[model samples]
Target: MTLTLTSLGGAGTVTGSRHLLEYEGRRILIDCGLFQGYKALRQRNWAPFPIDPKSIDAIVLTHA
Candidate 1:
């Protein structure tokens, strides 16, 4: 399986944070954190994640 990665948050903006990971026929999510300090950033949490949560096999949060 091929691993894929996508930045869901904290890239274009500095508010909410989210990351999507896929590898070896497995999917994972990292740092489903909310961005603080700005309304635009905070609104990201309300948006849908690019990938379905049900497909996630693991979650790894570093200081999340």
Candidate 2:
């Protein structure tokens, strides 16, 4: 089994926290929160996601 983790957002700053878990050719999104505060952070909200949304198999939001 192969598993890899990718940080879609929320790294250095605090706001949108999203991560992609790829396992066995399946992609799962954890914490689908919105990016808030600061233009840089909020700008991510408008920009296209690093990965394809349709490719994501499931979304598991950790919190509201």
Candidate 3:
């Protein structure tokens, strides 16, 4: 089996938030979270994820 890793969020921003993932045969989501401050940031919390939540395998969080 081959694993493909990707980052879904937190490319340049801080907040210690990031979404690292490996998906190919199996779909997985890393840190899916909301950042503090900024209305857009907060909105992401309620917004629908790009990938279906049901498809996510695990949610890895670096910090709260």
Candidate 4:
């Protein structure tokens, strides 16, 4: 089984925390947050998700 982690958002920036984990044909997403603060960061919210939302098997939110 191979486990791969991809950062969909919140890498260089401080907001929009979203990470994708794939293992054993299962895709799990960690944190589905929105970008806040500056206009540039907030604009990211308008962008489409890197992957299909229905493709995600599960979602693990760390906080509300």
lDDT by residue for model 4 (7-56), tens: 99997787899999999999999999899999989999999988999999
Which candidate has the highest lDDT of all?
4
Model 2 TM-score is 0.88
Lowest summed lDDT window (length 10), candidate 1: 9-18
Once fitted onto the true fold, the runs of candidate 2 whose alpha carbons sit more than 4 angstroms away are: none
**Candidates 1 and 3 compared by TM-score, better number:** 1
**Top TM-score prediction, candidate number:** 4
lDDT of 2 by residue, 1-64 (tens): 9899989888887778899999998999998877888787788898877888899999998877
Winner by lDDT between candidate 3 and candidate 2: 2
Ranking by TM-score: 4, 2, 1, 3
The lDDT of model 2 is: 0.87
Which residue pairs collide, candidate 4? Answer: none
Q: TM-scores across all candidates?
A: 0.77, 0.88, 0.61, 0.95
Residue pairs clashing, model 1: 15-35, 16-35
Q: Local distance difference test, per candidate?
A: 0.76, 0.87, 0.63, 0.94
Count of backbone collisions in candidate 3: 0
